[model samples]
Target: MSGISSASGILAARSALLAAAKAALDGQTDIDFYSGWQYPVTQPNWVATTDVHADMDPANIGPRRSQDETITLGVSIGAWLPGHTEDDIVAAFERAFSILNTIQTHIRTEDITLADTVLWCVPGATDSDGAVDEDGSGYQVEIATTFVCQHRVRAA
Candidate 1:
């Protein structure tokens, strides 16, 4: 029998990552000068709502082993602007993500080392909500994406 298993964890140092991302994108900066969209901070689903802080135990009895964990930060971007293409939304997110990495120094973290990345989502549309702009478009072509920030440190 192969007794092997793995565990993960994401110390809830900053559980408000979602809200923070939304706010950040709704700003003006060099990193946010792309995507060709106005700064209204649309789409609230641009942040990750689900994550896991894993810790795996060594299936052996030797000296000792420390558990490993990481903060899987996710982000998504949606647009209600009619006449907009999927590429537009993605470009906006890329712009926002770059800005995020630049100002992420303010956020608190337990682990000193951390990694940043944006997860890609499938290309499609969702149920119509309500037209915000012209074209009478109710649904939003969400350029949803996620980020996994790895870290290992102490909380402030």
Candidate 2:
């Protein structure tokens, strides 16, 4: 058996995450997913973005020296409000937090699989914050979470 490449491992991790998030947000028309922080001028009410990074260090196991690679993925969910009133800001925060919670729960409960690879997903820390525009015309809330994925490469 040949070991998988670092690029393959990262792609596998990202694919798993996308599947889980889609299932979690089922029936939510207002939600959208993006590759990076490309905020639109006419932004939607809610947005979820995915960013993937791989660690260079690899761990070897057993006599065959099977390799284990780590991939870290960051997911950010944002909520936008039309106004900067106290009530609007609070509502935006609530929406962002709710989305984040749903994501975490779905990830923990779901089994993530990748073809031709042994995968393990462990969720990491989470954070949230809210901000208002200087002109007090708009408000935004953001919540983020990190997932650490360990992929075991096949041994030759």
Candidate 3:
């Protein structure tokens, strides 16, 4: 947590994870990965929202003074095209799968474990107007995932 979000510290974890998510989402290597991603500084909406604290107490496992704490890092991807089809949806998922794999690799490299990481995808329209088109055929695939990560205290 030293860097916490600095360009060179552990705090930049969210940035790191965001990069990994994009890379994992796109099945292509970034020619200029650094410039390709513009990781916004850790916003109060993103960082402090989660409880990140750790301690070294062997007995803190069985039970704690407070309730069990948890945090979730949610990732989402979406697209909208006039003529999207089923194949497009499949491709979107395939891309997401690739990105998720790379994400796991990056996490392991940093010695962090992903807990309860789940992927959910669906297709829908973006029109805020609730009116069914008489003759409109299009598709959109959106992927939003939540990676529940926790600072493990003990094996128990």
- Runs in model 1 lying further than 4 Å from the true structure: 1-16, 19-23, 26-48, 51-65, 83-139, 153-156
List candidate 2 segments past 4 Å from native.
Answer: 1-8, 41-43, 56-59, 112-118
Residue-wise C-alpha lDDT for candidate 3, range 1-29, written one tens digit per residue: 31111122212333444555444435443
Q: Model 3 off-target regions past 4 Å?
A: 2-13, 22-69, 79-82, 109-138, 152-156
- Taking the tens digit of each residue's C-alpha lDDT, what string does model 2 give over 19-110? 67777788887777665666563444454546777764544554666567777888888887779888998989888887777777776676
Identify the leading candidate in terms of lDDT. 2
Question: lDDT per residue, candidate 1, 74-93, as tens digits?
Answer: 33344333333566455444
The lowest-lDDT stretch of 10 consecutive residues in candidate 3 is 43-52
Error of 3 at 146 (Å): 1.4
TM-score, every prediction: 0.37, 0.78, 0.39
- Quote the lDDT for 79 in model 3: 31
By TM-score, how accurate is candidate 3? Answer: 0.39
Best-performing candidate as measured by TM-score = 2
lDDT of each: 0.35, 0.68, 0.35
lDDT for predicted candidate 3 compared with the true structure? 0.35
